[model samples]
Target chain A: MSLAHKGLPFDRNRVSFKEIPKLENGYSAKVPIIRDEDKLIADSFAIALYLEDRYPDRPSLFKGEGGRAMARFVEGWSQMIIHPFINVVILMPVHDLLDTPNQAYFRESREKIFGRTLEDVAATRDAKREAFTASLEPIRKTLLSQPFIGGESPLFADYIVFGAFQWVRVLTSYKLFDAGDPVQDWFERCLDLHGGVAREIKAAA
Target chain B: MSLAHKGLPFDRNRVSFKEIPKLENGYSAKVPIIRDEDKLIADSFAIALYLEDRYPDRPSLFKGEGGRAMARFVEGWSQMIIHPFINVVILMPVHDLLDTPNQAYFRESREKIFGRTLEDVAATRDAKREAFTASLEPIRKTLLSQPFIGGESPLFADYIVFGAFQWVRVLTSYKLFDAGDPVQDWFERCLDLHGGVAREIKAAA
Candidate 1:
């Protein structure tokens, strides 16, 4: 979304869970490794900082130093708060969507990480759903005050969080939020941006 | 904390739950209401913005518009996320710290808000501790990457969160974070700032 926001066109290099990228000198097993001509950057936050610094004339990912820091906090919130909860809620659906080998790898890895079978995780999600939604209070409340996490306009912070919602939306038909939820409203607004690239994705039927 | 960061001196006017101040023109009853010369501002975020706009030459709380928006998100996180969790942990202790009449007001208000007695709330703290700490993962993870939520230097974002911690700290001997946690480290670092004003506050024995 930040890349799209910058209007920077690039070739898609979507890799699976087991595929590790061979860098010029070494290897990084991350999906978000970006190669900007000669420069290579790994990690989303670092990539955001690199893009902001490299393309000073383009639309900014961060407004300033303080913005950059707060965006990092948002990134942390997404990783720690949003992604974990979303992952549990949509685990089995996501597995079914993947190729057989990738599905096995996904189940094995997630089970190892969570210490529970995919079925077990899914079974408990019903009990945990209320707490999970309650955890979104910050984002919901933030959206109540502003249109986007990036103030009036969208920035990297919006993308970081939206990515979490998109992750779940593309895999499951399960409703994480109720009708008329402010968060659901913001998610819709996010999906509507950049020619609706996020909304255009094929989800589980 | 932002006030101290900006080198502004303030006369503290402590108000309890029942004490609502009568303003000159109208009555807006909230704490942290600052009388800045002829202008009176209520709420911490509004006050920060007013101070930043009013005292342009002073140290900035937010670096730019993005920072301001992100700080508001942090404020929402503190209010919605941190405050509620901490309130559960320290409600009884907080009541113990208040004056007799104020304690009655605090208990009555909190009971109404939470739909439970203060003792009942505190009783569940033991079981809720793990989930509460898990919620702090965002702050912990962010601090792992950066010194403060506002980045290298303390900004209003840091104060927004630190205020939540400080609120619980001054009223209770109950330790929220385990020793060696990154959030605990950041809280200590915050205490070390502004000439340790946060650290200097006397906790309830």
Candidate 2:
């Protein structure tokens, strides 16, 4: 998304979690390692920052320094509230999509981290149903007055929040928002960004 | 804060909830109304925006429009999570500070709004203790890298979050942050802003 928003096209590298350690001969223990010539940057956020700084003339991600900082808070809010909910909701589905060895690896790693089976974790989604919806109050409230979290047009803050919905959209058919939800409107608008780029990828049933 | 942060000095008008209806001959029915010559602005946030736009030459409250929009999300998070907790924690203390007539008014109004007595509401502080601490995770994560929410220097986003803590500071002795908590460090830095303006008002004991 940082790359897409920046108008800098790049080839995709589909490395599994098991392959993250071997990238660039143990350069970083992360999935989002981007190789630009001799330089390799890891972490989604660091890559966005790097792209923003390294390519100043391209379309900006943050728009300004203030957006750069506040985008982190949005990230914190999303990761703390939205991601945990969405991750659980799609856990079983995600596990189903992986190959046999990777599926076992996924289950093992996730179970160890969560201390719960995939079925048990996904079951917890119903309990967190109300909270997951309520957690989006800030985003709903913001979209009431502005077209995007960054205001008027998309910025890093909008991208930061849209990433969550985009993730949920591709992995599961679960309806996270109500029919008239402001977030639903915002999500559609996001999908249409950069000439209907995100919408091209059909959602997994 | 919008006034003080903008290097603008203004007189304070202490109006009780009962007296809010009488302000400007019933022009507005809320607190934090700023009168500039013939114009009257209501709502703390609206007043801040008005000040930011009106006083362009003075120090900016938001620093930029990005901060302006993102500040609302910070406001949303604070009001959603922290405000509920702190309001309950300081319910009795705030009621105690009011005169007999105002105390009855405060208790009646608040209890009606909450559907519970001040005592019942304050008691909820204990149950929400863990969640309240956990809610500060985003702020904790942000401060680990930056000194303030807006990064490098304070912006309206910093003020938006700080208002909740500052409210608790002056109204009650309840410690919201543990010693060495990053939020505490940030709160102290906020208190020291504009020549320690917030600290001049001693805490309620």
What's the C-alpha lDDT at position A173 in model 1? 80
* Proportion of true inter-chain contacts also present in candidate 2: 0.50
Cα lDDT tens digits for candidate 1, B1-205: 7678888897776666666655434446666777878888888888899999988799889988889889878988888777778878778877886899989888888899989878988899878878778888778777776798888888998888888888777887788898778888888899999899888888666
DockQ value for model 2: 0.67
Give each candidate's interface RMSD in Å: 1.0, 1.2
CAPRI quality of model 2 = medium
Clashing pairs in 1: none
Tens digits of per-residue lDDT, candidate 2, B1-205, equal 6778898778887877688889998988767788998999998788888988898898877767777888888877777888888889889988987888889889998999999889988888878877888889889878866888888888888887888888889987788877777788899999999988888889877
Kindly give the number of clashing pairs for every candidate.
Answer: 0, 0
* Model 1 lDDT per residue over A64-124, tens place: 8888888988887888777777888778877887898889889898899989889988888
Residue B172 CA displacement from its true place in model 1, Å? 2.3
User: RMSD, each candidate, Å?
Assistant: 2.4, 1.7
Give each model a TM-score. 0.91, 0.95
